[model samples]
Target: MNWDRIEGNWKQMTGSVKEQWGDLTDDEIQQAEGNREKLAGKIQERYGIEKDEAERQIDAFAAKH
Candidate 1:
């Protein structure tokens, strides 16, 4: 669940991310570039959720991956 590992494997992770947050466009995910904060922010924007909630979901997603 390391951000560094995700960042290093951003391209590979994109598909899973998209699968989890289907509302997000590819361009938005690309903009994240594997930064946890950016991805969380996007999830917040798309899902109308709080930042912490977004982080929690991302944490869970990363945990499974």
Candidate 2:
């Protein structure tokens, strides 16, 4: 469940991402395109959370999948 694996299987992973961040639009998820930084930025924008928090959530998510 490393970032590289997640990035490589991004299309399959999109569903999980949406489940974790229901506020994100389909377009925003697509914009991330498997980039951790981009996904964190989108999460930050939608949730009004700090960058660190967003990244932490992503880390947890990555660990799960």
Best of the candidates, TM-score: 2
The TM-score between candidate 2 and the true structure equals 0.98
**lDDT assessment of candidate 2:** 0.97
Error of 1 at 42 (Å): 0.6
lDDT of 1 by residue, 1-65 (tens): 68788889999999999999999999999999999899999999999999989999998998888
RMSD of each: 0.8, 0.4
lDDT of 2 at 3: 97
lDDT of 2 by residue, 1-65 (tens): 99999999999999999999999999999999999999999999999999999999999999999
Stretches of candidate 1 off by over 4 Å are: none
